[model samples]
Target: MVFSTEAVMRGRGDILHGRPALVIGFGKLGSSIARLLQAKGVQVTVFDIDPVRRTQALSPGLHRRPRPRDRPDRRQPGALRDRRDSLRGEDFSHLRNGAYVATVTSSEDELDLAELPDVYTRTIVGDHVTRYRTTGHCFYLANDGNAVNFIHGASAGPFIFLIQAEILAAIRMLTREDLAPGIHEVPAPDREAIAATWLSYFNR
Candidate 1:
């Protein structure tokens, strides 16, 4: 969330302060991004296919909106338009100029590029970059519709050590003879032990 938002706001020259943004998912990562944007004073509108997730977003001060309508009411002025206009039935023609669209969904279908009108321009930001442009709106595909934090050639910083420790713990659990074949939780003791080991190493 931080990296991509920085890329768009700082690198791409899209000032997020006081601008409107549409976040298409409200899961853990989505909610985090929405909160971050809101903290920056961006008016955020969120949409999720799941009603429960939509309700969750509302608690964080995000405006909840239903799925984009198939056709936007064309009577509104261009500057007054909202995400519903740009995302109207998956075509981004009506999105407000200067607004941002960030899709943090696991499924690419959440913001299908093929559904976009053919007149827009696309610039390659990276090998797997999924950003697109129509007029003044900037659309960022959070990790190109994949997990944003798991992009290739990018480091997870110090958090990588913790993730490694958790994976090791999970492996140890799998090796245990008493463990069942189905999904199982990694014991808290194992996680604590692994975390302690990392902390001790880093303290040296």
Candidate 2:
């Protein structure tokens, strides 16, 4: 349900700003979400049970997060402590005190946090109910607690694209093409007008 805004708002106050963060999944949505958070200047620490996925994020420019499986001393600079297995355990102790706790993984071997009723899960469900609800299909749980986890889903593609477009559009408007080569540039007037348009879309 397009919850990037709510997710950021709920967790923004707690973001570490410059400190490292651990993102524990590499699925489509998980990866895209991680990229967005990283762009905001948070040091991202990613982990995936799949060796290939983990290795991909580890590439030189990708700044892959170090896993405990990797040699201790040889671990990457942004490597977090060994908390990869625990879903709701001390494995995340390092991030407990950090600004943000972005748990995007749902290992088959491990329990699924989505089935549980937590703050993060509730937030996601609430976003869905708010944005896309039908009289007969409207089924949502009340907000009871904080969403500690955000499981990935196939629908992430469209949502990710929406967020990326908005962010890139903003980046383009703020900085010229020469200043940010990879970023898309939207004319200043167009940007303001489009922003208002998007706001109206959501307001409806």
Candidate 3:
């Protein structure tokens, strides 16, 4: 969420404030990104293959829409758009000239570079980070279609460490051979203990 928000906001002026933003997935990370974008006043649209996830994305101010078609609504021609699919040039024809595209999926195939026309400009946003532009459109292939938060220099952050600790605890439990073979809940007491420890360290 932080990385996507930063990518859209940094050096782009206030583009996110009123622009239309699309998030391609609706998993934990994608949902968080959508919420953050919405909080910043971006009109967020989310697409996911999972029906449950798609339903979850229909929040108060966010939109859940189907993929774009060759013939889009002519009434809103200038609206910004985003997509997540194996790139086809025709898929981009519906967007307005200045629209921005960012892909947060795990496959570079999501936005094939070969599909881009030769008249585009490429800019390096960071080490191994690149964005392409043509005419009025900007494209950010977030971590080359991998999770944006896992970019080379990015950290998982402090909160993630807490989750990691919980996972480690779960692993330890599995090793004890005292449990069933199926999924099991992590006890609330264990989570609370970890949270208390984390809070104490954080407050320090």
Candidate with maximal TM-score: 3
Q: Point out the worst 10-residue segment of candidate 1 by lDDT.
A: 73-82
lDDT of 2 by residue, 1-204 (tens): 114333443443423345555555666655765576577676666667677877777652345645554221212222222234434422222223212222232333332334433222123433312111222221122111122233223244434545666677776667655555554555667657665676677556
lDDT of 1 by residue, 21-99 (tens): 6665566656777788779787777766678987998887788765454332222111111122224335455555433
Overall local distance difference test of candidate 2: 0.41
TM-score: which is higher, 1 or 3?
A: 3
Better of 1 and 2 by lDDT: 1
Which residue pairs clash within candidate 3?
A: none
Worst 10-residue stretch by lDDT in candidate 3? 72-81
Best model per lDDT: 3
Report, for all candidates in order, the number of backbone clashes: 1, 8, 0
lDDT of 3 by residue, 147-166 (tens): 55555356557888799989
Model 2 ranges off by over 4 Å: 1-16, 69-86, 94-99, 103-204
Report the Cα lDDT for candidate 3: 0.60
